[model samples]
Target: MLTLICQGSSFALHKMATGLRKGAKLNYKLMNEQGISLDTKDNSDNNDDQVAEDTRKDSVFSPVKSKAQKSNASSAEDDGKHSLPEEVDSDDQEIEKLQRELETLEKDEAKLKKIKQKEELRQKVVRKRDEVKALRDVRRVCIMGDSIIKHLPSIQGVSIFAFPGATIGKLSFLVDSRAVPLADFNFVIIHVGTNNIANGHSLQHMSSDFANLVASIRKFNKDIAIIVSSILPRPVDHSHTKSTVQQFNFHSQDYLASELNFKFIRSYRPFCFRGDIKRFLFAKRDGGLHLNSEGSNRLRFFFLRVISTLT
Candidate 1:
């Protein structure tokens, strides 16, 4: 009986040991097959990224490159850049790609530079036109207002129909009867009413006076084209904070289209900051609100732009 019991115990222990061995082998197979590892970095086609970087480099180099391209090409060759590794070699094919990129950048830069140069040239032509034009047989342009344009110096062809302290109601030397043939002028620019606002002229009174001025000019020059440059922008300084000037401009702009020849020209975009003189329109010679040579040139260019559009 004792021997049989011991034999049973031995068999049970052996069975348990065999099961543990099988379990260890299964764990090893799973770990080996799955190969617990990670690929953390992304590897994608880098061609697009590299090409964009190359294009940017070309633009920066192309500015001075236009004059230097031939020299650089030769230098690059002598420096053995042509012998770079296959990955970055300046081989015939790669050199051709760089050349094409450089040309594209140079062309784009040239176009922008040309536009700026053209704007400057346009100013020169307009002034020449204004001078040559003043000497021509064109009708006179009589401006009536305060000092805004008082310093324009008498244009050769046109008579000085205005003076300092001229108000909305009456210009110092300007007579209503004289303005009858006004519409016959080649062009006209008017700026008035800052004084009126300061003088306590009500909106209604100012509007009425402006209407009279327009009517008088149209009556005189029946076929004259009106180029109404808005009131020169005023500075944002407290002394210039009056909104009535803007109100006057707004009202005039609204009424300007009523006449066939009346065309409102915004004079400040090129020289003034937006429409506010305080921010940008400092080109006036006085170093105040008015325009100086730069401002005059800007205006001259503006006229050309309009003429180009109309003709």
Candidate 2:
């Protein structure tokens, strides 16, 4: 009985050992199928974590990439901020250059205009000088005035240019227009200012007009003998007119005193008897504004005597 019991115990121990080995094998197979090995799972988990970390780093607003991109963006922004003003400054400099060029052009144009005007005036002066030098006749006389000198008898060498209601201004225009015809005469008698005195022109203005008229005549013929006839006396009742005429004549005589070949004749004195006008010397038909036949004859003789002296 003791031998049998020992054999059974050994068999039992052997079966138990076989069962433990089978259980270990089953566990190994389950581990292989379910992928539950520690080393392999740990390695796979590490790789997945690294991949997730890489994905998070590459995300749209990730801080790591955001910082680096922001740094790059900030550098670009700084460059733009610095360059913007430079572009604007360059544009402004270009505009300023254009403006300076335009101003220079305008100034040049103005200078050219002024130079052209000066040249034109110089040419006009030369032309007038040439016209004066071209005149040949010394005996031909021109008697130009208002209506007062219109009725003078025709003389051999005298040409009459009578303008009714003509003032000093009108005579200036007439002289300029008739410059060609007047160039023939060397003796010019200006019988004007009677109408100016009658029209009550200021003494200062009349004096200036007379000077301008004589200057105009001299421009046409510088060597011509110019005679400015005095304003004739009017009626005794016309006291203001007579006084103005006397003042005008006195001023003209003084003004023409230094002028070469210029004569201011006091023709009014011949018709005035001691500051009173001789009524017979003036036309009774026209309120003594004009001279009658006898007065005209006497004025012709007086002018003839002056002409003879010039010849």
Best by TM-score: 2
Which sections of candidate 1 miss by over 4 Å?
Answer: 1-145, 153-162, 177-184, 236-242, 259-261, 274-289, 303-311
lDDT of 2 by residue, 164-235 (tens): 899987798888786336677778888888788878899988877877887788788787878888878777
In Å, residue 258's CA in model 2 sits off its true spot by 2.1
The per-model lDDT (C-alpha) reads: 0.61, 0.82
Query: Lowest summed lDDT over 10 consecutive residues: which window, candidate 2?
Result: 255-264
What TM-score, computed on C-alpha atoms, does each candidate reach? Answer: 0.43, 0.54
Instruction: Give the lDDT of residue 38 in candidate 1.
Output: 30
Stretches of candidate 2 off by over 4 Å are 1-138, 259-261
Instruction: Look at candidate 2 and give me any clashing residue pairs.
Output: none
RMSD of 1: 37.0
